[model samples]
Target: MSDAWQHWAGFMADLAAVLLSLTAAALIPILSVRALRYLTARRNDHQRETLHRIASEAAALAEAAFADGNGPRKLSLAIGYAQEQCAGTGITASADTIRAAIEKAVMDYNAMVKPWSGLPAPGAIAKPKGESYSQ
Candidate 1:
């Protein structure tokens, strides 16, 4: 009959409309997640490269300071230089951290060099030369 056919057509139209709306809604979240992931990955790459550069420069400064003698004045200068280089470059470095790294490196170098200087040579016996401090 005509009434039954009309009812069937109305039901199918309603079902199609519901399916289309859901597909559109689901697309928004999928696109947003993809965009967010892309942005986060870019930021991480930049930070990693910057950190590597800061660490290398810090090591150079520490080595130079060690060669100049591990005195307070030299340490202070090294700290200041590192702070200037790494302060606002969007990295996680700080002056105190760099200073600590420099101190550790100096200590390690000193330990490595001590044995060589303290040990006597095969051809000569080691002893104090003279009272250089005598008045």
Candidate 2:
């Protein structure tokens, strides 16, 4: 009876080991895939943040450099500047994406800086002497 009990205990131990091994094997791939997806999502988020920052900078620069009446020129300049900056940083973005980012940035900037009157003309904010909005 003692010997039989010892044999049964050994079998149970071996079975537990096998089960643990199988569980680890099955979980490794799943854990790895989840880790990879999390890392990819983080990278994409960082890239998007970088793109938006670059777009905002480009829009501000264009606004400062170009006159208010030169809407087309400002758009072109901002797009070119954003594309150049993105390329320098190894970011790949479409023209439409950059344009949209710039537009959003401009809207945000205007909303923050421009006074909310009853009705104001678009792009008609006058800056005081030595007072810049970009600062």
Q: Which candidate ranks first by TM-score, i.e. highest? A: 2
**Worst 10-residue lDDT window, candidate 1:** 126-135
Q: Identify the runs in model 2 with alpha carbons over 4 angstroms from their true place.
A: 1-6, 117-135
What C-alpha lDDT does candidate 2 achieve relative to the native structure?
Answer: 0.92
Q: Going through the candidates in order, what is the number of backbone clashes in each?
A: 0, 0
Give me the displacement of residue 110 in model 1, in angstroms.
14
- List all candidate RMSDs to the true structure: 12.7, 10.3
lDDT accuracy of residue 62 in candidate 2: 92
- Cα displacement (angstroms), candidate 1, residue 121, comes to 18
Question: Candidate 1: lDDT over CA atoms?
Answer: 0.68
User: 6-93, model 2: which lDDT tens digit per residue?
Assistant: 9999999999999999999999999999999999999888989999999999999999998565999999999999999999998889
Residue 96 in model 2: shift from native, Å? 0.7
lDDT of 1 by residue, 15-134 (tens): 999999999899989999999999999987886556545555655565676766667766676566656666676555656666675666556556776848766686696446674445
